[model samples]
Target: AQSVTQPDARVTVSEGASLQLRCKYSYSATPYLFWYVQYPRQGLQLLLKYYSGDPVVQGVNGFEAEFSKSNSSFHLRKASVHWSDSAVYFCAVSAGNTGNYKYVFGAGTRLKVIA
Candidate 1:
């Protein structure tokens, strides 16, 4: 069994500041790590994925994450965040099952950017 967790339920940040979101996972085998962002009611967009080699994975919209095997964590970071970046971020994990596999999503961290 594989699972993902995001500790923070909400984060408030000033616009143009550095930001980071936490993630942790529990999996017996190597799992596919992913970060997704949801603007409102739309489907989640893949920010990045960590499957095999690289520990540090680069993502879209000026975001990146580091995969730590020992800690079982994959945390997302952004050097500078915009007002538009204020949204719900979800961490997900999937076992390598291609046939009708499902991704477990975090509760979500609502990022509120203040001006």
Candidate 2:
């Protein structure tokens, strides 16, 4: 079984500050990792994803994530965050066995960027 965990329920940062959202997962095998952002009253959008290749993947805007197989962690980072970056971010994991896949999501971290 695979599961995702986001320890931070909410985070507040001043505009232009750097931001990092923590994500951890547990799975028996290699897992597909993803980060999604949901704006107020809007659907979730993919920020980034990792399946293979580089351990670090570039996402939309200035967002990026680093995957650590040893630590079973995938953390999201932004160089500078704007007020528009205020949203709920979710970390998801997908691992399959025998053609049956399991997708699990974290509780989500609500980010509030203050001007």
Candidate 3:
């Protein structure tokens, strides 16, 4: 079985500060990793995803993630954050065959950006 874990339930960062949200996974094989952000009352927005090829994947709004196979981790990073970046971020993993893929989501990390 595949599972994803976000160690921090909540993270606070100052505006314009750098941020890194940790995400770890447990899977026998390399699974598809994704980072999604959810704004208040809004749907989950895809921040970044890593399926293959590059270990680092760029996402929208200056977001990016790096997939570490050895560490079984996919961590999200932003050089600088804004007030709009404050949201609940979720790390998810998709495993199984092409059509039989199953997604396991993390508990999510709520980010609070203060001035």
Candidate 4:
């Protein structure tokens, strides 16, 4: 069975500070990892993803993630975060090869940015 874990339930950071949201996954084979952000009352939006190739991939905004097979992790990072970046961050994993490409999402980590 595949699973996703986000150790932190919530994180508070000062505005303009660097941010790193940890994510870990468990899967037998290569996994399609993704990072998504959900606003208060909006759908989850893709922040970054790692399918294949380069371990590090750039995403929208100043976000980026590095995939580590040995660690079974795909952590998201940002050089500087703004107040608007406050949201619930979710780490998800999907095994496309499996008969059912169902995605398992982590509990979620709420980010609070303060001035």
Candidate 5:
């Protein structure tokens, strides 16, 4: 079975501080990993995805992630965060050939940025 675990349920950081969101996954075959950010009342938007190529993938909004097969983890990072970044961040994964492409979202880590 494939699954994802986010160590933190909520994270609070001051504006302009660096942020790191941890994510761990379990899967048989090589998995397709994704990071998505959802603002309040809005749908999810893809932050980054790693399939085969580069171990590090970059996404919009100044977010990036690194894929590690050995550790089975893909953690998201940002150099600096803004109040606007205060939303739910989700780590998603799909095994092998990407099912439904619909994504299995993590329980989501709520980020609260203080100014």
Candidate 6:
């Protein structure tokens, strides 16, 4: 069984400050990992994903994530954040075969960017 843990339930930062959201996973094998952001009433938007190849993957809105196999972690980072970037961010893991996959999500971390 694969599971994700987002330690922080909420995070607050200055409008232009750098941010890092921690995510840890437990899985038997290396699974597909993803970061999604959800606005107030919108659907989940794919920020980035890591299946294979590069350890670090770039995402939309100047966001990126680095996957560490040994650490069993995939942490999201942003060089600088904007006020609009404040939202609920979720870390998810997908396992099983190509078509038949199951997704496990973390308790989202709500970000509040203040000026």
In order, candidate lDDTs are 0.91, 0.94, 0.94, 0.94, 0.90, 0.96
C-alpha root-mean-square deviation, each candidate: 1.5, 1.1, 1.1, 0.7, 1.6, 1.3
The TM-score of predicted model 1 comes to 0.93
Best of the candidates, lDDT = 6
Residue 29 local lDDT, model 1: 78
lDDT by residue (14-85, candidate 1, tens digit) is 988999899999887778899999998888889999998989999898899999999999999999889999
- Candidate maximizing TM-score: 4
Query: Which 10 consecutive positions of candidate 2 have the poorest summed lDDT?
Result: 94-103
lDDT of 5 by residue, 1-115 (tens): 6889989999999999999999999887789999988998899988889989899889998999999999999999999999999999999998767454545668989999999
Stretches of candidate 1 off by over 4 Å are 97-100
Q: Which parts of model 3 are misplaced by more than 4 Å?
A: 96-100
Question: Residues 2-66, candidate 2, lDDT per residue (tens digit)?
Answer: 88999999999999999999999998888999999999899999999999889999999899999
Which ten contiguous residues of candidate 4 have the minimum total lDDT?
A: 94-103
Indicate the worst ten consecutive residues by lDDT in candidate 3.
95-104
- For 1-115, candidate 6 gives per-residue lDDT tens digits of 8999999999999999999999999998889999999999999999999999999999999999999999999999999999999999999999856453789999999999999
User: Backbone clashes per model, in order?
Assistant: 0, 0, 0, 0, 0, 0
Candidate 3 global lDDT: 0.94
- Between prediction 3 and prediction 6, the one with superior lDDT is 6
- The true-versus-predicted C-alpha distance at residue 108 of model 2, in Å, is 0.2
**lDDT, model 6:** 0.96
Q: Estimate each model's TM-score.
A: 0.93, 0.95, 0.96, 0.97, 0.93, 0.96
